[model samples]
Target chain A: MTDINFKKIIRIGLIVYFAAIALFTVGTLSRLKDGSVFGLPKFLVYGAVVLVLTVCVLLYVLHLQKRLKSGKDAFGLRVLRTIHKYRFLIEQLVTRDFKIKYKRSVLGVFWSFLNPLLMMIVQYVVFSYLLNFRGTVEHYALYLLCGIVIWNGFNDCSTQSMRSIIGNAHLITKVYVPKYIYPVTKVLSASINVLLSMVPLLLVTVIYGLIATPKLYLSFAVLLLPLALLLLLVFCIGIGFILSSLMVFFHDIEFLWTVFSTIWMYATPIIYSLEMFESRAPWLITVMQFNPMYHYINFVRSIVLYRTAPTFLEMGITALISFGTFAVGLLIFKKCQDKFVLYL
Target chain B: MNEERKLMISVQDVTMTFRREEDRSGSLKETVTKLLSRKLKFSTFTALHDVSFDVYNGDVLGIIGRNGAGKSTILKIISGIMKPTKGNIIRNGNIVPMLELGSGFDFDLSGRENIFLNGAILGYEKPYLFSKYEEIVDFSELRDFIDVPLRNYSSGMIMRLAFSIAAVVEPEILIVDEILAVGDENFQKKSRARMMELMGGGTTVLFVSHDMNQIREMCNRVIWLDGGTIRMQGETKEVCDAYRI
Candidate 1:
């Protein structure tokens, strides 16, 4: 913060925006009174340039801002610098979380992949055969697996991250590193588990003859899954910041979240399909649409299971939900973070 | 170049208050009920009150106080672990705190892994820690048990390990809070020598202890904090003798 260089994009945006203003000013002063001009007045020409530049610059700044968007000190170049400086600490934290999780378990990291696979197995039996349900949804295993993959990723990331800051009270009380990095570590650690679980996700798809079709295997939709995953990662980190900071003040948040998440899981169209609700209980479809998790899973399911790219409307909703929660999360964390040591 | 006498840490009118529920029930349900019934109450405990001090580069300062005299609170503030409720602290250069040795070490991790993990927690970059790896282990003198998990290591062993890791890096500022009281005499001598070496290298140290003798021996200046306020501060012997009586 004391001496930081704003990254190239922001610097460039500022420069361009100012350049436009300069052009506008110059145009305003130099009237070019000899009005044998091409269609419009000289001032009008400058105004046009200013308007165009303003639009372009505004869009560019907004895009650059999506990464660390909140504060003069909170976001932008300096925060990135601290993260870069403390990258190793974050790496070690993530490593510790991963190691501790599987430390004494008989099935260490195999459980990462196997847990979802087993859950899918049990879900397949329960949902497909026992209930004799699942109307018109093809590739039920792949469908269920995709939803589990994304939902579990969200579940683990948010759950662990919400508690991550409080869990590391010992370290925080004794050291000075960025507080947000702890939640980031949890996000990355759980994301690693989620990312690793994708192996089985792809395996199940290939095994079930889902991806054997050339168009399904080679479509551009295949590439968008990782982008979808990154969106989920950012979204969860934002929620993590909000929840972890809130939990410090309200110790009940952690327990309340447990109940809320259970309700949220049922609310999401995970085990059941949205089409069923559309056909039977259409009112629940409104709530399903509002659930961020539903939109994200629908986007991914569209790409992976159905082999069709998500529509612009779906993509926009997903991004809006993700970025909306992320911005809210950053605001909450920044506001509450300074008082953390007091509460802790 | 020639920064030896520059002011390193300046604390200006820092005050801290922690709130406690005076007649609160433990359960959220009971707390809510009492709150609705106009019975819930809280009291404020001030740990520090407008306390201010400055330490110059290459200064070895000691903080001596009786129990609950805010000695550790000052250390925590200087270390940047706790923010003051009021006032500001302007600090220069990298700071390393040795407050309560082994407080951050994960007992389940091996000593070697904990070294890296601890170094990371202290904001030491991975490459830098790896470069100082051998020296840290050697200085700890627990080389044989370096591969063993810390839970298996005795308390003294953990202290040595914590001290070695914290002191190995010659930071611009160091804060210690009574961690040397636990280890054996030989280790204590070793740690004191290392701390002196750090001072010789121009690291400003803010140390806290109840031992007046040690304060008089090592510190160039001493601040005696009592009841969350600075009772007296001057040269080492002046304040130590005043507090001892």
Candidate 2:
């Protein structure tokens, strides 16, 4: 009669993962502040803790995955049915969210195009002209454009997904679908928004004459944008799962996230460059390097703006960060989902 | 009544405890204080306690209770919408639960779109809904305005659309809430006829309602729930008279 609560166990895995990330960040930062190599005893202590935490989470994920494969639970089976066999429902939900977003609006989905273009102009005027950032940064328009779009993908998805679980309470309790699908649907809708905005990104590239400088075959770097987008989308969904689930328990996260995003936007090399902080605050540059958005934005900018492939090392690290967040996010969402009926 | 029907659903000792935030302080500051002192306060309302029941194949089991009697909670648990705090539920076949009439119906979406949306929400595949689209519309009698947004329709019209889809789906097991208490007399009659048709096709039904007369007519057996416990259960007429006394 009693079965394993995959939801509860997975959520605990998420919390452990969160602790691991925080501890790993602190450990890395401590090593940097001590001006010692990562081999310092302090780094090892932190590293061991983080390693154990990650292993625990990984083990749990594997365990649940095995159970899922064996088709053991009624609730789990029903949820799987909703996600895979009833895949049409998820598609319909995405379409419904997309359509509702543009309903009754005058400019409609074209705003996706005009929004980044207008923001690029305004940002170019302020940062390029007022601050004279162009003197320090090459092709400042394209740089700022890439940052805005990349940051927007994270920003919009996080914000929307924070509300996705609680906002759809009416439907979640009424239907027996997988509760996690709501956050996935939000991520998909946000991905579509980002997809449309990519048009202006290309237009900016054309205006700047970056495409012609390279051979046609060399332009293949541009194709790397999809891989980068896929990476970021999964990352957002991961973070979305975490934020949306936690927001149900604590009402203040939504408010806190707005402030966090503003700080995060500045923390990443979005409007400014690593050059600006080089001599004055090398530590800030080091911290920015640790930011996931820095890796993602810089990776795409390498392809689209700089006409170079992202280094393999950089690609692997970014993948780890995104996939790590997604795994943790999913764990937390499943954990918090069953109790959602009580909270909502 | 044939006594040899197979078991359609087996519910055993399902217990649901609802944690009610009673006299709780909302401020984060107070929450921190409570955390330090360990005086956080709440009360648990047991909605269903040790509830056990079963549904035979093709039987209409009517559930009756006062409002806070865990009647609706039982329906939700059996439908897998909300997992019970404690129990075992064995479902034999595919189930379609119309737990809340007009649930998952978006107000801004057209009636036709809602049919697909609601049908999908009820676990119907797209192709099946497409096959039943015209029949559902015809049954709901909304041909004149299926394209219009559902928000424009009156509550009765929405119920008509909802009932039509639920009826057309032909689920093996149907868990219905108090959906029949809506619309006019004509629609209620139509809904009853549809229920009879489902019963004829060997579809087991578990329904929750307060109408004594209707329960007597539609149900062969009835169970009375009170304060999250099964107070009485027997043949419909016998249980109804005992409940009245």
Candidate 3:
């Protein structure tokens, strides 16, 4: 009876999966006629490779179904189980981080909204007034705000998570909670601030839209802002895992990260436009393209500043980078976690 | 004792070694310089050496040793806080390790918030904590001050709160390390009674304490550690008698 049910489920799942793939292929083909499918050939190749890889994975899972049921779980399943078991712990820790951060502050949670605005203003003055980037980008305030919000989320998440394991030494030495919970929760709490800061970004966009000449209309593309932020959050969590694990062994990572993030902030086209770098050093733009933050910030900019839907290629790149980093970070974290107690 | 009793935990040949650096390097630069100058040196210290033991169902096992004799290390290994360098431990049930009470509590959080946070850290689900919330507060006698931040809490009050939250949970295996003394005289008596109640309720326990009297009173089995190795293992009375001499 269970065998039949499993076969039936797999059949339905494959049908749905193939149907979605067919629909996407047709959409890509339609876009191809208009010559608007960005790098169509490459996109199709990646799509085909992804399809084949997923099919192979499905087959492998089916082959291992018997072993999976007998007691030993797959790695991903074990991770999910661990996550499910400790979800409330994660929630409590995140709450603790939020409370502790704003405990003594008079402003309290309002700072999450105000922090990005203040940062945008500081950068706007430095770049626009001093560097004469005032007229460079349309809706420059919104542009700066968008970049700052995403960059700050990444910065805060990575920096705070890097310290999470060491910071929670009192707990680590005494308990058996999964070590990964620390970095994961830090990313989650930091993302809360990122989420709050988006309100100001939207407000600026609307206020600027009312005052601008060609009235910047709020596009349906604005709906994709959350998707972009989710991708950024995933990327941050991955980086958090890698950094926190490393920080346990090497105390120097903290100082190194300070210098690293500052350099990283400059590499990302936040205050300065990519056009500025394109003119003087064309090669820098290529290097910037490789930077995951560049893709993430650009993804946000495409939605809010450009007022357009991100192309599938852009979405694909962000997903790849985010999940790829996540995979690597998880691997490093899992490998090092058992040794953390010794180092701590 | 029944020979057919089930094993709650079986620890086999566990060994833990710590490599201590003569001059600890906290940075890459220092490490690189030490490597270049041939000054990097390390000394090995074994915290546990080929330790093996079994905890039967509902057996209250006590571990006693002087400082650096591996009592805490063994407890930590069994509680799953630290991985053993060599050996395996098979645990049959959930562990609530009260190695240090209120270790996961945040001082900035309110007394009420710390209860949920500490409970969660000890692996209690939200609904469980919610049901026990009022009871924990009542037991801690901190209902009036539940909303107050823990930073303002006196050390005894914090210990009372920690013990109350910990005591309410019914764990399959309870691993505690030298934290029995808590709060004032009245509260300590209450906490000791609570501990006895949990022990009497047939929960397997691994306890580490310096007080031989406490071990003799509480534990059915005892393992006396000496210099990272098990020097003796037998009935609590037998082992405690030997250690006292």
* Candidate 1 wrongly placed segments (more than 4 Å): A1-75, A210-218, B1-4, B23-27, B179-185
Please give the RMSD of candidate 3 to the true structure: 4.4
Binned by DockQ into CAPRI classes (incorrect, acceptable, medium, high), candidate 1 is: medium
Task: Please give the lDDT score for candidate 2.
Answer: 0.81
Which ranges of candidate 2 are over 4 A from the true structure?
Answer: A1-82, A210-218, B1-4, B24-30, B179-181, B184-188, B199-201
User: Higher-lDDT candidate among 1 and 3?
Assistant: 3
* Isolated chain A TM-score, each model: 0.77, 0.75, 0.81
Q: In model 3, what is the error at residue A45, expressed in angstroms?
A: 11
* Local distance difference test, each candidate: 0.80, 0.81, 0.86
For residue A244, what is the lDDT in candidate 2? Answer: 86
Point out the higher-scoring one by TM-score: 1 or 3.
3
2 or 3, which is superior by lDDT?
3
DockQ of each: 0.60, 0.46, 0.81
lDDT of 3 by residue, B199-233 (tens): 77889988888888788888999999999999999
lDDT of 2 by residue, A1-344 (tens): 12345667578858865764664363235232342245565555656766896788687577667767787555544554445555777777788778778877899999899888888899999998898998898778888999998888789888988899888888877777778788888889888999999998887787667454332222556756777898999999999999888877777888888999999888888889999878998888667767999999998888777766566467789999999999999888888777887777
Put down candidate 3 lDDT per residue, A1-344, tens digits, no spaces.
Answer: 01223455557867876665554454334233344235566556656776797889688657556655786667655554676688889999998898888889999999998899899999888888888897878778788988899999899999999999999999999998888889999999988888888888898889988999778877756766767887898899899999999898889999999999999898888888888767789898778869999999998888787767567777898999999999999999999999888888
User: What's the TM-score of candidate 2 when only chain A is evaluated?
Assistant: 0.75
